[model samples]
Target: MRAAEHRRELVTLAYPVYAELLSGVTAGIINMVWVARLGGHAVAAVAVATNVENLLLGVIFVAGSGTTVLVARARGAGDRAATHSAVRGGWALWAVITPVVAVGGYLCREPLARLLLGGGEGGSLRLATGYFAIALPGIAVLFATNVVDGILKGMGDTRTPMRLAAVANGSILVLDPLLILGCGLGVRGAAIATVLGRSAALACGLVVLHRGRASRRPAEAAECGIGSLGADARRTARTGLPMSADFVVRMAGALALVAVVARIGVDEVAAYGIATKAMYVATMAFYSVRQAAAIHTAHLLGAGHDQRRAVGRQALLLSGALGLSALLILLTAAPWIMRAFGSQGEVAEAGALYLRCLGPYLVLLACFIALGGVFEGSGASPALARVTLCGTTLQLALAYGLSGWGLPGICLAMASSMALQCAAVGRMYLRTGRMGRTERPPATGSEADRPWIPAAAASDETH
Candidate 1:
């Protein structure tokens, strides 16, 4: 495809993904708003509960993200059996994993709540345990909805997932007041509302999936290479585990950075917290482009095309523009942005300075993240995950060493770490491009089931 065509396709896929992600974030904020009315204890309870849910999301990515890539590849190959296998793999993995998480989490609710709340026996601890009782079991619905979304996105339908997110979040918005305040269920009400909202969306998603089943007919087991339930599940897990690990590592790194910021001052920590939330608006856009690139690259590769270089270039350009636009906006309106979040005085000043100093890091991060998607689509995610692990560790060490200089020092550490990561990915990209030049397109549909990376590129990444 032409460069213009590739760019256009990426934009089409990315914008809806961005909207879906943004809606989820907005809903979480609004959910917190309603919970905040019950006082600090309620807020604390919901906060920790939601943080646990966020971590749990990484676990489901094994099913959700793996299905996306595999289905996209199968679709491109026009292999109905492969598509069936991919979808089955996602649900199979979900079935095996969900029970352990939901049932085990429920049984350990009180202990989990206490651990999250620093082992307190206060009202917050009780509220959190109550919240967990409902939310943990309700996670099954959330996992199912994510699998539905992955299937849709693999079929190149990003808008449907965006609409589904809106549906779920809208339901939450309407239910929150009624359940939490009007019904007097307190923190448990918040958890209930969340579960009900997601369940409603999942029902609708299932209906959609059913209606579209004609396109994904049942296939002969012999035609689907890894057709057995166990084999399919294992394949999905293998494909997605690296992506899940990457997400978990990043989350852990972000949490660890808070400790380093604490060494600066309490106000700085508060500023860091607020600033990070604000930064999500920009980061979501980068990730959207990344997803777009991954889907597009995988689809094309499955069709026996090696267009990773083209897709990566367009992804970088789109995400780079987004990063530059965000940098300019933050630089000019940092104070206003901080004020809009209801911060003031030392908190606002520190946050504004941090935002202003974030330009280089954001730009570098945008490029690295966008490029990482190309790797994810091409079966190079293990290498990408390793780079993220190293970069995150380096970021923490640098931040601790530079803490005396305050938030700007933290920003410096982030930018430096991201720069190194980008260099590593860039080298991988160049080597892959060189390898692609000498490669022939796959001659059969079964070849689509194989990893996309050439031996030369894979060898380079391993070393």
Candidate 2:
């Protein structure tokens, strides 16, 4: 049996990373809540601008994804030289990538905002452009933070980023009004505040890593050891690429869904803003488990554990629990949660109703995420990306079609899509037999499933 403390250590590391992600998101939701009253135009602007930002975030996600794989494997293998080398290489790459993203964001801001917001003459286009312009230059901050964060995550240090996120979000809370209504910054102010918060997060992460300092002592201390960063960037690239693809493609589809919603009118957009916010809170546990399971599975795969099946099973089980928990929260909090966000009774009612519809489908959402862990662990990122492509495409198509039916249509569309996506992914996963100890039939298994087992060498045992 695994030591109680060992299991807890894994859980502990995952907690802060999840919290960091959720807290920053919470801050965004609160910010959006206040923005909703400013006007639907403003809400639409923020949504489009945020989606643009997420697009950029998807690009850098590969860097973090690569870092996590490198860190997990190197540390698992006790290769101190390789770990430090990777740390240095990661920093070097970000120095180049950050500025590139920032400049691109700055230049693309107006056109992209116009496109996503659909450029109405109501001055909404100008407002969204304003937000996007300011948000664009801060790409450097966002890039730097995520890259450093990936390194930290690889090291099993989720809390460092989480604490930093809290600081960043707190700054946003303080700076939002100062820039927006106070100095007459409006959307620009909000954008600036977000940028500064990201910069702060990057700064905190830098300090944490430098202090932790890479060591070539894996031969001496089992835990602190890491392999050389001498591994090909291409390999890291190959590993992380699918993860980035999944995020980027899925986000692209999400934005497309938003664009469709925009056509339904700003009121629908505002309603969605409120509902999505509530949904995120209700769904944090799912996000948390998926992230934790992915990282843990990566480490386990690296360590050559014999329990791939067990790990996969546990991750999925955790995901189901999380999804069920989200459902209960959605069902129970549907009314009050909506009421808390928007002052408009109809908006609140619509959002609450939407949440209730989304409740059961949380099951599908969680399971899909669990499957992502398997792909990440096995380094079959192509599979991971394909899974995302199929699921998101289906979801997007449904969302686009159902949106014409109004609020319920939008909710049902996405929820139903999630169900279909999960089933598709789960079926493929079972067929692959990557999750289990034996190359047993998937109840009926992917081409990768064979009689051969890639066992960790006898000398590589962790404890």
Residue 187 CA displacement from its true place in model 2, Å: 3.5
Alpha-carbon shift of residue 322 in model 1 (angstroms): 0.4
lDDT of 2 by residue, 1-463 (tens): 1444334543676567668868867766756866676788887788777767768888877677776766665565455644654554465556656788788767877777767766656667888878877787777788788777777777767777788888889888888888777787777778888888777777777777666653333344335333333333444555567788988887788667777788677777777777876666545666565566566656665455643445556667767877888888888888887778743767766677777887766777777777676667556667767767887788777878887788778778777878777776777676654433322111101221234344755332323
In terms of lDDT, model 1 sits at 0.86
What lDDT does model 2 reach? 0.67
Each model's lDDT = 0.86, 0.67
Instruction: State residue 460's C-alpha deviation in candidate 1, in Å.
Output: 23
TM-score of 1: 0.93
Per-residue alpha-carbon lDDT of model 1 for 281-384, expressed as tens digits? 99999999988988887787666676788888899999999999999999999999999999999999999999999999999999998998888777678888
What's the distance in Å from true for residue 342, model 2? 1.4
The alpha-carbon RMSD values of the candidates against the true structure, listed in the order shown, are: 4.0, 6.5
TM-score per candidate: 0.93, 0.81
Per candidate, the number of residue pairs that clash is: 0, 14
